[model samples]
Target: APDSPRALNGISLTIPDGQFLGIIGPNGSGKSTFGLCLSCLLRPSRGKIEVDGLDTSTPEKYWQIHKNVGMIFQNPDNQLVSTTVERELAFGLENLGFPSSEIQDRVDKALVQFDLTKYRKHAPHRLSGGQKQRLAIASVITMQPGLLICDEPTALLDPRSRAETLDLLYELHRGHNITVVYITQFPSEVLHMDRVIIMHRGAIVEDSNPRGVLSDIDLLERFNLDLPPTVKLADALRRRDVPLPAGIVEQEDLIQEMRDIPRGAPPGDHPESESARPDPTETVMELVDVDYTYSKDLPVSTPALHDVSMQITPGSFVGLVGSNGSGKSTLMQHLNGLLTPDSGRVLIEGEDLASKETDLTSIRQRVGLIFQFPEAQLFEETVFDDVAFGPRNLGMEGDELTDRVHDALQQVRLDPEYFSHRIPFNLSGGEKRRVAFAGILAMKPRYLVLDEPTAGLDAEGTHQIEDILTRFRDSGGTVLLVSHDMDLVATLADKVLVLD
Candidate 1:
């Protein structure tokens, strides 16, 4: 028998009925595994899990326990198996032997509830990552289990969608008497939980009320987790001896506290002459009067982009932000010549992307676009082959191929020796995402366009990506990043394009 790694190590926790619990931790900290164990999807190596007085370990009680528990996985692709959105929503109901009328009614309600009516007949595999995530949550919640476990269900969602999903979870817990276990990386998402549990290395590191949990800054730092924006800024003011009171975690309170401080240079006051700006002559890519449509069949045709125009300057970081279906991903695809415009011009280095002589292959090589879902980028048998596939096509061999693959893995924090021969499909969701990015990095693109680049990354992994993007930009490369994290975009983007 193969010696598989232990997902949960001596883990124990008890949940009271009708309580809303929030679990927070860094990636690979056993959060997802813990969720799986509690939901009866994965039996623990040594511990027992029970739900609603039924033991999950007992085969006879399996259905009884499964009926009381529902789980939404972190990876949307892994959870979606039905051909269409509607079918996926009805899957659990059908498995529970619900009548046809009941299944249809629940599926119909879910379609409207999650804004999925438009995609009722669309295949889950063909949907965008954010869409699939929404579908996954909708499907599980429709089953109406007594205990719900969600593993980063909103990680791939845009800001508005994430808010809606969280609101729905709160409604289920507060209105429907559901015991909710919400697992997330974002500190703000867990601020309202009745109880908060911080996990590290398959063990509970901290268990306390949300108020007490949020007040401890040092604990968060030790675990490498990001603090809520207001908490972080409040800590900053305290560090500078500004006399700001401690434990201020809300934006309004933090702002009021700043107002009480003696008048001084405004928060961001700086010399106008030294302000940040990039040279206009450094434009590396440009889009003018672009328009694109998908699924030309009259019934399914959808216009993704319209009269969209933008320019990217070398050494500049650009953020593309919008709602879930607001053309952000479609625009990123255009940057790398993946999709030709229905009209207008995409100019990269002064060459028209639509021209037959422009060599689209070379343009794709120069402009790397990582999809919101990383699974699309992986196909080779091993991790090493996947990363090396890019350079290998460019005639790289021997030492050069070895160095490129190794460096790419290291850049993404994956141990080269340990992961080089491993199958890409066996890695965790976050690990798969990183390996995909590394594959693109090996190509050494001059202009990079990433869609939802930090979706599945943890606090530390996100920082590593930021560092890599900054280094690339500082080295005369241009990056057009598409992300829904407003704070991240505001902090790193030299320019922002907001689509309605």
Candidate 2:
């Protein structure tokens, strides 16, 4: 165990009471490790952590520490233990021996606060990605812990849900004076934090106020951290001799600053040119009048897709966007026959997926699906085994299999030598996501169906994914990307589809 890598190396820091702290870093950079240690979920190998004068190293203080600290993991599925949404919120309170009346009150308020009142009886696992993220936040805040540690909590959420979750956390911090340790890959989210710390290779590289840290674009780029779009634009403008004011992190600030700047004459309008469209007859994948429903014959039956029809041409990159529970994920499941439409046809390369003779396994091999939660797709003991599973099943063996695994890991920016034998279950959230992606990449599918592939990934990780997708597309691979980030979609998608 001593030979294993140290997630945190001689980290020494102290937090004041009722402070809102933000942590940012590249993938596998120990942000999650630091949060785990602070919450007492993980014990430091050598250094001691004290919470409210109580030593976390002391066995007797573990209960007190746990009672005072609540953590929302990067993956919501990991923490959800109850069958129903309401029960999930009450599970922690019930464990703490709260009264039934108070638990009910807290659960009711949390459901309403998270906009999950109508789905209180629904299973947590059945909720949409954004809904599940909301439930995870609600479950923790319901317990009303003195300290809260959130590790990439907004990664799975839609834009509106992200805004709501951040507002709720801010309210909890300002109104209740709850100490919040927020770890995220999004640089803009740290704008309002009292302090921000940048981590790299298990060490704190930068610790300062939000503006001080964010304004250092070179430092952030060096750490593979993403800059806010507004900040990047402002930096570019400043470099071009524009007198943009400092601290332009938010869109509003940039807009206000631009309003004060002198404007040149408006450019003459030109007619927009339409690009040549692909032939509908030549398609890689297509859905015809598709309809799907959950619990079709049961009392709680809910329709997911209705008359949905779309054609994805070969080597095309299509972006799917919608609100929470808007059937984006359900539609994706139909692509590889994971979920067959009740009354429609799914065709892959002119072959109907519903045909009895069509080989589903072969289709799946050609169309790799990356789940929203990376953990769901990872089951093997080690990263090497998981990534190799796909290629190995395709009859690859020996050096060929090893080469595929190593190349896939490298494609995702993971060092195969360092991570190959490492257990995936023990890796950081971002690392797990990358491993899952590498697994899909090793499969070398002709069509890649990704559901929020960039979710929970750092800036460098995101760019790596973008590069992989571009290369894949250029090599004649089709990509069906489901995402909530408009900028990502706009930058990568050849066409965009909106689902209701």
> Which one is best on lDDT?
2
Model 1 lDDT, full chain set: 0.85
Candidate 1: tens digits of C-alpha lDDT, residues 1-500: 24876556677789999999999988778998888878887776676787887877888987888888899987788889998789999999999999999999999999998999998878787676778889999999889999999888888888789888999999889899999998998877888889999998778999998867777898888898898888988897787667888878778888998888899765644456553555667568999999988865556567888998888777788898988778888888887688889998999998998898998889989998887777667999999999999899999999999999999888778899999999999887678888898899898889889888887677887887787777777777788989999878987887899986
In model 2, the worst 10-residue window by lDDT is 266-275
Backbone clash count, each prediction separately: 0, 0
lDDT for 197 (candidate 1): 93
Off by over 4 Å in 1: 1-5, 256-278, 373-383, 406-434
lDDT for position 268 in model 1: 46
List lDDT for all candidates, in order.
0.85, 0.89
* Error at 206, model 1, angstroms: 0.4
Candidate 2 ranges with C-alpha deviation above 4 Å: 1-3, 239-241, 265-281, 373-376, 379-385, 396-435
- Report the error of model 1 at residue 254, Å: 2.7
Locate the minimum summed-lDDT window of 10 residues in model 1: 268-277
